[model samples]
Target: MINSTIKHLTFITLIIIGFSISFTSCYYDVEQELYPKPIDNGISCDTSTATFSVKIYPLIQSKCNSCHSTAISSGGVSLEGYNNVLSAQQNGSLMGTINHSNGYNAMPQGAGKLSDCEIANLNTWIHAGALNN
Candidate 1:
């Protein structure tokens, strides 16, 4: 009778231990999923002079610079000039912020998101080579 009781107690203890380990592992996995690591897909373009006045500048002014420009300076960032945009790219903040889904807040707060066509234009400009003109 004593041996049987000991065996039952051992079985219960083993079950509890297993449950605890699995529960701890699941908790860790949930945390990892909640906060994923950053990924760099790389710039999608090469060096080429793009038309800034017609193609690039307008997009920035309309879609981004309202809050991101020197005047308001949201997030301690600016996108007023070509040099500023280029500097953002060099510092990794541009791509980092745009690609992020959560780490940093999206630009143009409280406004509609940029259209796909506009995003494509910007991507094309960057891929062709960020231009000054």
Candidate 2:
């Protein structure tokens, strides 16, 4: 009877140990499966006129010209036409306002900031010589 009881307790202890090991290993496997890995930040730009029309102009019209235009002219920066934009670029003022660290008084004040994608589009355009066409 003593030998039989010892065997039973040993079996139960083995089963518990097996279950604990399985459970912990399963959690790690699940964690690895759920999160594959993160990719790097790869940004590319196409210097096409259509890309400018489709990706760039709308951003300026929507975010910039409302405040920085001939009619309104907030912050003394007019972004209505190509010439005004180029002038700002030449004098290094356009990048200053666009890249302003202060959140409250940036261009398009009192509205939601432009998305990272939109800003990237503008940066690409500016970097590509700020073409008018």
Candidate 3:
């Protein structure tokens, strides 16, 4: 009787160990897949024709829209429409904040500063008269 019970318990223990190993091995966190590193294609960024619809709007939408959109408008600033974006640009806050210049609030709140290429693109667009187009 004692030998039978020992054998049964050993079998059950082995089954539980097998199940635990399978379950743990099947699930794993992939750091790279979860948070991918930004890729650099070794090509220079192009901002020659930085139109609002094509370049400026999309950039702002991805980066600034979360905090400055019409629905939320954090800090009483709205970058939803072209007019609102224009206001920020005209007043120099857009450049100041993004550039992390002195006496201006660093933008995107907690995120890293925009890349040099991105900043250059914005500067190019603004210098090109910041047209609605």
Candidate 4:
């Protein structure tokens, strides 16, 4: 039964090899963790076409609208529509509050500040003349 024994040993060896390969091949390689992203590595924020409808409106609706809507008007600020938002911007409170600049209240009060990308988007929009679009 040497032939039978040899076949069994061969099968066992194949199973061992398969398991070794299966176990070893599944290692994950997350490039971001290994290489890491550089902070402010010259990647400018995308502010082109930062329209009110597409970008600014949605951002305010989600973050600030809850408190600043016409119904609530917390702190007497109503960011209900285009005109109100425009007023805030024109009066310097929009950038001041959002930017958390001194002499102005930090908006989204009690929550973490808006992300840098968001502030950059607003800045770009304002720089582009703060149009109704």
lDDT of 2 at 14: 100
Alpha-carbon local distance difference test for all models: 0.69, 0.69, 0.87, 0.87
TM-score, every prediction:
0.54, 0.55, 0.66, 0.69
In angstroms, give how far residue 100 of model 1 lies from its true place. Answer: 5.0
| Residue range 1-133, candidate 3, lDDT tens digits | 9999999999999999999999999999987666654323334667776889888889899999999998999989999989999999999899989989898999978998887677777878888999999
Candidate 4 stretches with Cα past 4 Å from truth are: 1-44
Clashing pairs in 1: 45-127, 46-127, 48-128, 48-129
What digit string (tens of lDDT, one per residue) describes model 4 on residues 38-111? 33334445666689988899999999999999999999999989999999999999989998999999999889
What does candidate 2's lDDT look like per residue over 1-133, in tens digits?
9999999999999999999999988874555355543221234334344244676667778878878889988877788877887897788766666666553356556776665555666777878867775
Q: Taking the tens digit of each residue's C-alpha lDDT, what string does model 1 give over 4-85? A: 9999999999999999999988874555455543222232432133367777788778877888888888878888999988
Rank candidates by TM-score, best first: 4, 3, 2, 1
TM-score of candidate 1 to 2 decimals: 0.54
Model 1 has an lDDT value of: 0.69
* C-alpha-based local distance difference test score of model 2: 0.69
The window of 10 residues in a row where model 2 has the poorest summed lDDT is: 38-47
Candidate 1, residue 110: how far the Cα is off, in Å: 1.3
